[model samples]
Target: MPTKSNNTGGRGGARAGAGRKKSAVKEKSENGNPGGRPLEVLDIPEMEGVEMPKPHDFLSAEQRDGSELQAADIYRETWEWLKRIGCSQKVSSQLLERYAMASARWIQCEEMTSKLGFLSKHPTTQKPIPSPFINIGINYMNQAVRLWNEIFQIVKENCNTEYSDEAPQNDVMERLLRARKGN
Candidate 1:
């Protein structure tokens, strides 16, 4: 006679896991999803024909268009882009107006400076018509002034001479004169 194990209770239907085998060994529901709703194959909302990225995937660095642009650099670039687009007079006028009123106010300030006749009073403030633009990369331009300062500091620290001991200056009069004389 076979001995009846206390654990099985001599019945295999539920206790011995004959019918409860699946319950004992929990089947991970599709993706171990707790909710009844189906697990999403794609993270983003998929279109009729277009596919979406999976959960593990992400937008590439190139796909990301971030504001690496500085205010001054943007002012320069927008003007350049406007020029490249080669707008008609009506469109140009509209763009310039919109650009002044909305996107940037720098041009408006520049126009005012010229119109106010104070441009001559402040000779240093009067610059040439800002054209012949450079394609300065946004990433580089943001840190331009900061990098320039760092470079200047490096030069000041490293290029020590007798003049280095001289007092701080409003202008480099000596250097300016020498440069003018083609020294």
Candidate 2:
């Protein structure tokens, strides 16, 4: 007598609709807050009649030229932004100084790379090698990103106001902050 064979036709895999059912989870918005529980909005107190400190107080005299000067400008602009958003009290002057310097250095390195090109000559072998400015720029950019992230962490957790950019379209720092927030 012939035995009855399975109808799978030698197929060993799972059939259609055979896996576990997916849970009906609600999608999160940009803030990553689900609608079930109430989100705790932090109220950062605004500073009243405070004077913005000069960059010379934080940066040494020797570090106040070219890109460093630009860094100083960046620091001032960021301070004003923080003040406007009511989170200036949360971040320290030292942190802003560091962030500015790193950003400036990154830009300086990128400029150098663009001007000098990516290839360089070795000291002894005289072979074409990747420009040192490329790695230096990347390192500076990483530092700037870390510092910016730290600043934004405070702002995101303790500030209820939306991050608004009223600066011109050419504002590099503002653009960078917005990009970081999107991430």
Candidate 3:
């Protein structure tokens, strides 16, 4: 059997596919296999001389077209979740804004991972893994989730107190009487 023809440096040029960028997965000749990578094709002028690009530059065109979601989206989504759980609008927005910086980081990281090549799926689950930029994104997401949970806990407790009227409070007269009696 003949080797395959060299592929052209089509869409995946300088930018890695951060979005759904399409690159020529393979090119072929009818006869036999042409060669190794782009540089190795032989005997065919049109098929030969094709150049392979750095794999890292996968998303340039994809980024240009279908960009990743902004960091604000995370806050928006999280706030939406809070609202569904009965948090007030003020509380929801506060939850989003509390970790604005963290949200930004999370967005970038998530985008990088999401936009990787289709074949670049994860080994364990056959899902895609994140790129280097995803480091910041993951960290940011974790921070926002932690902070959101913390604030939500506080709000939940407050709601319980206000609705149940179970918070401890000494009446003025009771305090005075108790003080006099040293009770």
Candidate 3: Cα lDDT at 16:
40
At residue 18, candidate 3 shows an lDDT of 44
Instruction: Compose the digit string of candidate 2's lDDT tens values, residues 13-71.
Output: 87764665422122223446555555555455666988777776444334533323357
| lDDT top scorer | 2
lDDT by residue (tens digit), candidate 3, 104-142: 445445544555622355678977664555565557667
Worst 10 residues of 1 by lDDT: 52-61
> Scored by CA lDDT, what does every candidate get?
0.30, 0.68, 0.42
Which residue pairs come into collision in candidate 1? Answer: none
Q: Which residue segments of model 1 deviate by more than 4 Å?
A: 1-147, 163-183
Per-prediction TM-score: 0.15, 0.64, 0.33
Per-residue lDDT over 80-114 for candidate 1, one digit per residue giving the tens place of the 0 to 100 score: 33233221111233232232222122222333344
RMSD values, in order shown: 29.5, 13.0, 29.5
Off by over 4 Å in 2: 1-45, 57-68, 166-170, 173-183
Error of 3 at 39 (Å): 76
